[model samples]
Target: MTEILGLYNYWIVIFLMMTGFYIVIARENLIKTIIGLNIFQTSVFLLYITMGKVTHGTAPILKASHGGESHGVEHGVEHGAEHGHELHAAAEGHVDLGVDAVKEVYSNPIPSVLMLTAIVVGIATTALALALVVRIREEYGTIEEDEILEMDRNS
Candidate 1:
């Protein structure tokens, strides 16, 4: 059931992406297409945030107190206070913290990097599209693609 929930969330993200794609493809207005593109980008961002949510994983920073006082080797033991927490690098390739198993899961950095790139791309596309819209407005005094087409026909 938990797996199903995760799958449902993923499906929702995919649905958002597809809806945005459809809107872009089916709409004749350039501004509407740009909106759809933004929607598509937002769906991808949602997926990234959802996947990056770690239930118990701490920050990647290894502070002096949070680790061992001697050699900084984390055996994954929870001390009386949160100050003495050490990172346990399991020998079997799995660290068990006896409480939250999520801390053992390796953090994925790819999605984060990809999301950064995607954001930049989305911004660039939006800027370019807006510039084109401005030019179209100046040329024809209207933003509707169909109206522009009619003007062309009349000309």
Candidate 2:
């Protein structure tokens, strides 16, 4: 359906989330579990990025087709005179100087910024997990969960 196709990114996020969860729950290898965690993290990132997007949206940058100091000053003076208020340039003079004609939607940037931070934290967590796994392997001489459990039981 059109609705289903329109939300394809959500579908991908769901698939990746499930696949990662399956790997984490079903696999015994620590490295594979780390990979699964990474996959799960990526799914979260994709979800956030997708949620932050807007249809036909542009960046949050302001594009001034008719904006300048003179325009702002003139508009401000006119607005003040019409409203019978003494609006100074610093108060409300430059409120709608150049962006009144711009009706473009802008995507939210907070989600993307938070996801970027999450990505860095995820990488650091993965590295620490892998390092711990390496130490475990060195101490146990095996990376298999069952074998390690058996070794522990015997010891």
Candidate 3:
């Protein structure tokens, strides 16, 4: 029961993904297609947000605390590197905080930040696509895929 509960979000994500995929593939109207694209984008955003979440973690904000220290060495670090010391190697793009070193478990913020940027871009792209659709509708008198193709072939 607990395991299933934990995975409810995943199930929701899958449902959204499938719904969006179906819309994009099965629709004929240009506006509908754009809506489908938006749905698909929404699912992607949700997926990224979900993946970034930590089971018992908080936000990835650094807080000042004078609490007790931790102990343990992390893997994938240099041989001479000390335990509980994370590397700030941007080239490698990975850091290992030793076991229990970070008292407050913070969820990875990278995905959330990236998703924010993507959301902005997606909004702009969606707006542009809708504008193009409006123009297409005005010129062709219809937004259906078949009608647009007929118009093109007629021209």
Clashing pairs in 3: none
Displacement of the residue 123 alpha carbon in candidate 1, Å: 0.4
- What C-alpha RMSD separates each model from the true structure? 8.4, 5.9, 7.0
Better of 1 and 2 by lDDT: 2
Best by lDDT: 2
Q: Write the per-residue lDDT of candidate 2 for residues 1-155, one digit (tens) a residue.
A: 99888888899889988898888888788788889999988988988988999889876565565346546667667877776747554345355543453465778888889998999999999999999999999999988888999999999
Report the candidate with higher TM-score, 2 versus 3: 2
What TM-score would each prediction reach against the true structure? Answer: 0.65, 0.74, 0.68
Clashing residue pairs found in predicted model 2: none
Ranking of all predicted structures according to TM-score, beginning with the best and ending with the worst: 2, 3, 1
Q: What is the lDDT of residue 8 in candidate 2?
A: 83
Worst 10 residues of 2 by lDDT: 93-102
Best by TM-score: 2
How high a TM-score does candidate 2 get? 0.74
Judged by whole-model lDDT over C-alpha atoms, candidate 1 comes out at 0.72
Compared with the true structure, all predictions reach lDDT values of 0.72, 0.81, 0.77
- The list of candidate 2 runs beyond 4 A from truth reads 61-94, 97-102
